[model samples]
Target: MSRHLRLALVQAPAESFEQFADGLRLRMKSPNRAELVVYPELHLCSRGAEAMTLEEYYDTYAEPLDGPRGAALGALARELGVWLIPGTVLERAEDGKVHNTAVVYGPDGELVAHYRKIFTWRPYEPLCVGREFVVFDLPGTARIGLSVCYDAWYPEVTRHLAWMGAELVVNLVQTSTSGRAQEIPVNTANAIVNQIWVASVNGASPTAQGRSLLVDPEGHVQVAAVGTEDTTLLAVVDLDRVAAARKHGTGGDSWPWDHFAPDDTPLELPLYGGRIDPVTWRPAVSPWTPEALRPAVPAPVPTAPCPAAGAAGEETAR
Candidate 1:
């Protein structure tokens, strides 16, 4: 039995929330209906260039997950009757720190999962790092993992998700004009190495190269946009293919995880777990605190005193 998921990658540039909504409606209304639709990273703030200062930009664009914009997106998802990964946005959490957050809405208009980008393309872009890699079941489809932009660069991000039973990885990207050259290959490699499907969507602006892509488990480019143009690319992802690919191995002698010895390995990295306060959205205990499972460092061996020097001299002489 072939389990197929029809997905659409939206590559349109929006200058305002209205424009974004319109673009989404246009894609949704397409004759070919998609079961899932993905948008680019920072789609809500694509007009930030018009702001005078960084603070001004964030202030004008950043919104809470349940804010008016988020509500509108949820409503749209319900209206279209499609699972929507509406790309990333500047999420102003209750902690007062802004995060590059990707949100997923199910067809019933509920926020299913929220993933913060662990790797903030730093020095180049100033953004707070996210602490969690979120994965969720897609009901009738495969398990899904969420990443944004630079997160795809780290092989561990996808591997961790795959290890946790994710069959498809969606990366929402906002790359600089010169970045597409690098972004495409890295994401392609991620899909191949992890033996999972990858759907990457980038903003269709001059600043962003716009080349959204969908790579199969075998690292084949199933759908890709040509240039910076307002367009949507559609493709059918087969979970059956993912299973078949994993069975064949990742084009290597052994699975990547097989290379590591499991003995004495910590069950979980303390850095990766936290308890967030539901109301405040802040961590009850910081993830940065050292974990108890960390292996203790062995003390340095005691050295012989003057005898060592004498012994060395005797050895040399002999």
Candidate 2:
């Protein structure tokens, strides 16, 4: 059984919700429809709202995960018989603050997963931040991870997703600034380091600078650069390649995952005030486990510098 997945990344710019729905309908009507269709960030927030205050705009359109927009988006996916990610929505959380949330609707039109933007664009984006990382299994296919625009800037987010067994990470972007240039390399670098496919879909034209890309696990550009036009980047990602890359190595040579040796002491990350044990650092069922990873055995830790060369009996004392 070939673990190949056909996906479409829609780099459409900010448009009215109705326009987006119509375009998606046309997409399904076409013979080239993909199994999964992903749109850019804030693709349906309605661009005209820029005239309003941020608070008023969000309050006006923001909704819960199961709000009307969610229902409509889910129905569209089910009607089209395709997995859909309609990009990030303004989520009116229970805490009275709105959050930029990315959602996934399965072919059945049921909400599969949703992640709030943990690294919201900061001072510019005045919304509540999400506190969790999310990864979802795509049934018989590979595990897929989700991230918003600015989240890709933080490698920790994607790293955590890969650690959780994600073979692909999709970052829905809506960057209209020159910063998009810097993000190009960042996307590829993330793929190279994590050894996972990355689909960074950005909005196009008047709303954003476009330039979406689909990078493979080996950091190979599958669907390279596309201009600031309404584009649908398509590709067939092979999960087998992901397994092979980790088992063998990226480019069949570099295996950074082998950096740790079994029986090695936990490494301290002063940055996060955390330590990771070599043997159990990765999540359960990970390739980094002791038996599966089969890393090189390390030297035993010397106990307190040999007790200052004390007597033989004393040396063995606790």
Query: Largest TM-score belongs to which candidate?
Result: 2
Worst 10 residues of 1 by lDDT: 281-290
Which candidate's lDDT is highest? 2
Give the whole-model CA lDDT for all candidates, comma-separated.
Answer: 0.76, 0.83
lDDT of 1 at 15: 54
What residue pairs are clashing in model 1? none
Show model 1 residue runs off by greater than 4 Å.
250-318
Candidate 2 lDDT trough over 10 residues, lowest sum: 283-292
Q: Compose the digit string of candidate 2's lDDT tens values, residues 131-154.
A: 999988777776889999999999
| Cα-based RMSD of candidate 1 | 10.0
Itemize residue pairs with steric clashes in candidate 2.
Answer: none
Candidate 2 has an lDDT of 0.83
Task: State every prediction's TM-score relative to the real structure.
Answer: 0.78, 0.88
The C-alpha RMSD in Å for every predicted model, in order, reads 10.0, 5.6
Give per-residue CA lDDT, model 1, range 259-305, as digits (tens).
Answer: 33323233444665843222321111112212331122323334435
